[model samples]
Target chain A: MVAAGPNRIDPYLIPALDGVAYGLLVFVAASGLVFCFGVANILNLAHGMLYAIGGYTAAALLDGGWASLALALAVGVLAAAAAGVLLAGLLTPVATGNHLTQALLTFGVALAGGSLLVAGFGPDDPRVRVPAALDGSVVVAGHRYAAYRLVFIVVAAVISAALYLVVRRTRAGMLVRAAVDDPEMVACMGVSPTRIRAGVLAAAGALAGAAGVLGAPIIGPGTDTADTVLLLSLVVVVLGGLGSMAGTLLAALAIGEIQTLGVALLPSAAPFLLFAAMAAVLAVRARGLATRWRTT
Target chain B: MRNEVIRWGRGGVAALVLVGLVVAPWVVDDYTTAILARTLALALVGVSVALLTGVAGMPTLGQTAPYAAGAYACAVLGSRISDVGVVQVAVAAGAGAALAALTVPLVVHARGVIVLMITLAVGELVVTVLGRWRSVTGGTDGLAGIPAVRPFWGLPVLATDQARYLYTLVVAATLVGAVLLLLRTRAGLLLRAGRDDETRLRASGHRVPLLVSGAHVAAGAIAGAAGSLLVVAQQYISPADFGFDTSALLLLGVVIGGTASVGGALVGAALVIAARDWLFGVLPGHAPLVLGALFVATVYLLPSGVDRARLRPRPTDVPPVHPDRPAVREHAGAAPELRT
Candidate 1:
């Protein structure tokens, strides 16, 4: 392992940087899922489609300029938020149902929505055009990395800080925490649980939409993009111990590194790495994690 | 009198279905027969899904891992080791069970949706490995041109669609019957009890985790055997056959069948698989739309999943049967039921 010495470290520097950006991308995408699941207790399987909504919006609307980027973000967030509202409406009838029913309903929505998207966009991976300013790669540690990817580090940091502030410092955040802790009590307090559910989903959708737009260049808009993002987000949510923001960020970053740096380091085991890491982390965190979530 | 009449009616329906299955290959066209054969394999996978999801109280979309394991194991070893269907089925079952056992720790710790996510990972892992292990799985295009299988030693190799369909039907029926019989045993009772209340089951000196693990392994074996049937039925195998869509369809089929009913799962799975094939053939690009719409509709129509009251009453919180109080249990006997 030490045979390659300091030269080995130089080649891995780019993937490590990419890992940070990728990890943050995952954290941004997954926090929405964490929000929905934690606050609303609804496993919105259509969460992926919401992200895809943003991705396809980016693909169709972006024409390689700052104005286009701003336009894409606004439209993407609005569109995804609207879709989230629609999902909440669909979920009303089965709102009190079991996980199986909820999962089935949302999964159905994802399937139907994803297909409709393909039909609309045509069954092909759409090209994502970055803004002119971020079009080229930047050299880092004598290696080149996409400038757009590096942008996620700054963008995601701002998003996370803003999210933390909103959740920690605001009345809405307190209500959300209360809803997660005890919805029946929240209902008793005259705050309609329905409104709360809708609001949480909308906010979650907005987060996913933003992630989709920004992460499009790296992950891109495609037939497979929704599923890939959904799977990674799911892994992050689980490994993050369900609802803790800090845990999710850590998990996402770890996954990003595993996906990038780990793969670079152990090229032969690339296929097995993502899930293998998931299984290993899950196993180690097994009973402790399960019981902890139950109490929460 | 009503219960007696219902039992007789159910038996009559079973007889009719059995006779119909026996006569199907003769009545159907070759193309339809082949599809039916493949559907039978999938229906068998649905049975396993139901076993875990409905009976074991572990919602899962991961049976495809074991199913793929069994299918690949059979595909790779069938020619070199043995082409006899029974031999391959055993090999496949072992592979599936082993995979399930290895994964039991990751699974048994959690309940409900967590299990679903974990199993999904297991399935995705297998698919990823299968896709990359190109030398073995032939990559994404899948392993094709697997030879026709023999049902048993000294039996003729199944060549025609009619022969393959009949073989699949018989094997599926046997495995399903075995599952039905198993559910009528003490193990089944413990499994049901564990699902209903793990705390109570544990209090009653039952090992809930062990029961979950056993049911998981048993279901994996059942799924594995189904995988072998798939290879024979299609004479071709691909990763697409075991995709997330397949798992979703199978799980929904189990729900349609009433989660606790083995017979329901098999019938429900068969109906779903046939529906997909028919939909694809008839509607082209609209297959997913139709199926997805059906899922949404089903959720609204049958929230608790197809008349569980009729198939198996939600067993009320019966006091745990203490080991020494077999006499008391006899009087309160919910007794092992054959839902099939």
Candidate 2:
């Protein structure tokens, strides 16, 4: 394989880049789920709607001016974050091991959010255009691809790096870890779990929201996108073992490859292919590695 | 003695409610009657969730898979055999119960979030098969042109919306009543005891897994019967009809109405369906957001559920007061172990 040299390497770079970029996007979308589910033991089924809301918000603002992408993106993240806060506030008192209430409540929220998007966006599919600067294609090693994709890949890297730093280095990160490890002890130390939980949920919502804006051009905003996005995120979170960031990153990359490569290999059952892998994973690792993260 | 008396009183109230439902289609307009009929069909699904979540203490998000199985079974059977509504319902219920039996054994050992994950995976599996299996499930296009179900044999039953409404109401009420009666049995007490705590029940000499799996099977049948009725009502069966949203909607109905009560489940289902229809029609695209907000609101406002008071039989003169179950509300001195 090493002897194949640059000639062989050239052929695989595009697929590899696509896989990595998609993987990073998954990380952004699922990291929030990891925090809420992994640490707080709260199952927020409506998490995907945060991303959907963000994408629609960005799509709406994109029409005003291309220069407004930054503001639109910010607004989208904030709106979704607000939604997260609302959800956390509403569910904090009632969430329990029953799972029925949590699942139903979140499902309702997802439906409601999706409907609201349809009402505002007029039930038509919407797309965000690539920034003019990164719209064109570039040739590298005799391969031509969208220049914007490479930019997206780079942006994803920066976000992931920042996330690592914040989680590893910040005081808030310590509290989060402690809360997940032992919520009572954290509470006994005068740390308000409610505030911590709300903050985490809000941040996760913002992250999902940002991912929506970033991924809108690629996936587009459609009627079923919310469900599709959520399923993918759930797959990623499960694959990564629920609460582990490193696990999420690794699983996202793997699943992204499975999606792209599975499509390349078997186009007919491409969608079913992802879940097929999930079933296999679940089968092999019964109850999943994240069982430890289950707070209850 | 007090608990027994309360139970008997609640039973009487339930019977009264049943009579009221039986008469609804006769008095209401065709549109309202049809809507109520649809509500009853959906209510059966809610009852299935109540069986698992409320009584059995196993919250399953994937009841719709069995529900879809029943629907598809009815669709296929009705297509090939008689289109009599009763026969179609039987086939649907049997298929649903079988599917539930098959799935429950795998994850009944697990609890809480694990149960949720397992059921979700099962649901996705069903949907995938329905979408891709093509031959039996009709792939994504779904089984279409499901013939209308006749009320009886040789007699041309009125196919008007009002008559169909009455038929569905009767079927739904009968099914709901049967489930309620089942819950009142000795076996139902065992199931509820298992919900409170499974370890203690095991010590009490009850076979926990059998009860758990039994609940799963029964819930599955209820869901399936509801799905079958839905196929008859709509005269169509699509994979979309049995998707996650449908499952979620049923669950929402159960929780909003309250748990562990047939009346609560039916009321919740009616409210959820009516809300969805009215909201979707009036707001035009805001159905999901409204439902989502309601889900959050219901959980926040009533952790125990809207009919928390009805969970325990209250004095007729003074209305029951609903209270939040802050700490675990398992009976004192004998915490019912939630195990299987």
Candidate 3:
């Protein structure tokens, strides 16, 4: 894997770290989509718009310097969650077990939201100002890397761990999983599947929002950012198998590496490597990498 | 006797529409004529979407990939070869079919949302490659100055806007007629049956994937021909012309026209094109917003599409079988009989 140079460590380490960070960002964004699909049975095509909204909010708020970076991130995430809940409310009436309707409706919402953002923020790319505490680089094995990236990696890892625990160990998480497996049975058991779906959608929105806020610096926020992120998230979610968290994580990491390393190694062919990987994976396993959520 | 009269009436209406299209350039302004030609070209794309998503039940957002391939093929071939407009269209169809063949294997087994995502990924990949390969596609600038199309036969070239409009009208109508005929065939029935129940189709010993692949190839050919016509109309081809937005718009047109009816495709395409042109002219920056709102409203309020509104109750009209309903068994222990 090493290049034919004395200073090969930086070249290898940079892409490796970059890939991990990018993967973690993708997982953060896609985890919400997976949860929404699994629990709510709603494939929210507008999830990307939520990410962009969050990034734009963070970009706007963080510039004020009235609160700390953590507070700004919280506000951004909360705003996104609120927006998600509102969207969920609007869409619930129309969802009605029709995947095509849900897809089209959400796609319309994405287009509207994207256009609104463009109208508000203009078409220029917006950059989020990283806090001074995480602005500098740190030496790792004699190679300096962005401190914000390390923070993103650690924060995303912690979030992943917490998500796993919440889904596996909590009663609410159990209910969500049960609801995903069979909404009718859950409803029969006196659980309001609609409420659970709304809550899960909100949580997913929060995660996407948080990802947007943290990842804004890396990916940058622009008019087309939502569509780009949505495409990547779709790739991740499909490869990971619609409702499988583990599948999403594994797929996100694998795709992240492919994207970064592929770009690094072959710039011209990099754009196609992600789709090629997906095609190859689907060829071997038509249902994707996981078969746990095959019911839908 | 009544059925024959109805059929003749339908044929007469089609003939009138064809006549109107042929005379549109003279009746309308040059700008409207251009828009009419564009709408016809786009309506051809809607027909392809109708065949795939409406008839075969394979929803794809990647139809733009094949469309782009066809446009690029036409542009390159038209630039290189002389006096072969019909041949250029054939080559473009071949390019689209080749792309469909390449991607169908990856997408055929997946259903619903997975199919949408995989196709979208395929489209993005194509667009990315086209954007990067600047030497051929001209990157973002796109391929311009395409040679004027030469009409077939040892005849003079078609130079007037009216001539171009008539040519495009004839081509689009022929393709639409072909699609309508195809839909009445046994293979078309099998394709629709496969959409309702792939397992049953497979049990009956039909190759579902092969049928789907064939539908996709047909769609590609139609879209390719449309792209070729578009190039001939505008004399330019660009990546922006065949992006995700275009795919979404085409799908919207298909849904609006009513997926089940052949005429719906043309109606939907015309509505979308007219609405887009008018909205862009009126709102300028907010056309997408209006378009988006239209999509949402159409999905919510007009689920069966404009065709349902225009359709009148007839004695021959039978209630569609709900595909979601399980087949009933004759006995409690016996296997359920196939519904159809």
Best by DockQ: 2
Model 2, backbone clash pairs (residues 3+ apart or across chains), number? 14
> Candidate 3, what DockQ?
0.36
Better of 1 and 3 by DockQ: 1
Judged by DockQ relative to the true structure, which candidate is superior, 1 or 2?
2
Cα lDDT tens digits for candidate 2, A1-296: 67577776566677767877788888888898888776766677888888888889878887544577788888989998999898777667764434566666677777777877887787788867766777789986689978877888888889988998888899988788777788889989998878887898898899988888887776577788787778788888877876677889998888777667656666677767676666556545654432453442
> Which clashing pairs does model 3 show?
none
Against the true structure, what is each candidate's TM-score? Answer: 0.92, 0.86, 0.89
TM-score of 1: 0.92
How far residue B117's Cα lies from its native spot in candidate 1, in Å, is 2.2
Instruction: Kindly list the per-residue Cα lDDT of model 1 for residues B132-236, writing each as its tens digit.
Output: 889988889888878779888999999899999999998898888888788878998788777666777788799888888999999999899999999998888
* Prediction-by-prediction clash tally: 0, 14, 0
RMSD of 3: 6.8
What digit string (tens of lDDT, one per residue) describes model 2 on residues B1-340?
Answer: 9856655665676667667777877787777776677677877788788778677866666898888999899888888888777788888999999999888656566655555566777888788888887888898898888766787787564477776777777788678768767876889878877765566678779999899889999989988988888776776767777777777677667667665555666667677878887787787555667777777667666664632222111122343233554212322111111111
- The alpha-carbon lDDT assigned to residue B198 of candidate 3 equals 68
The pairs that clash in candidate 1 are none
Evaluation by lDDT, superior candidate among 1 and 3: 1
* Evaluation by TM-score, superior candidate among 1 and 3: 1
lDDT of each: 0.82, 0.74, 0.76
